[model samples]
Target: MTDTGQAEQAGGLSVVTTATDGIRVLTLAGEIDHHTGDQLRHALEVTGTARPRIVIDMLRVTFMDSSGINILVNAHQTVTEADGWLRLAAPTDSVLRVLQLVGIDDVIQCRPTLREALAL
Candidate 1:
């Protein structure tokens, strides 16, 4: 239960970042569109960690667009290249449908709950 204090709010998105047992968890709320994609990207960026394990708690996310999808794909690739992984957790029904439609669910693991996503 460590808070990185890296919470950020931009556009209609709010991100609260915390670290649990070395895993970075980003709890996101609001809409994810072109205007807020940069904020999401910043939050996903790994600073000093060689292998970054990230779990995005998306339960509160209200909406998402292509920009969010692209950012997520890029982040997934970046982390995978470093032998790490990114997981999406508890996305709302609408957001989950979007991810599924874009085939993101097949690429990145999406769990039904944050606790499940964080479980190793």
Candidate 2:
């Protein structure tokens, strides 16, 4: 898991990375707001630069605001420009609602599970 130093502190959002067969999965937890969104973006941008298949497992994320959504949208464009794709996996109901409300859920694929995201 690639530990972005910021998430290491207490109660900070954590971005853990694991890759298999060139598919990188970033497991995110805790709040991803204005403060932590940069950490998430950095991790995704770094991984997105190398791998085409990127799955973001948000099953454990407690809260995500507009900043977090913006990061994902930017990441989506980054991956797609490389002929790759980004999938958001297993978001909580609250997060899912926000995504749907903004129509991002339609633009960016949101899988029911990490396994499902990886499978595609």
lDDT of 1 by residue, 1-120 (tens): 899898888879999999999999999999999999999999899877889999999999999999999999999999999999999999999999999998999999999999999999
- On TM-score, the leading prediction is 1
Against the hidden true structure, what lDDT does model 1 obtain?
Answer: 0.96
Task: Report the lDDT tens digits of candidate 2 across residue range 35-69.
Answer: 88778877887442544878999999888899988
Q: Which ten residues in a row have the lowest lDDT in candidate 1?
A: 42-51
Q: In candidate 1, which residue ranges exceed 4 Å CA deviation?
A: none
- Candidate 1, residue 95: the lDDT equals 98
Name the best candidate (by lDDT).
1
Q: Report how far residue 25 has shifted in candidate 1, in Å.
A: 0.4
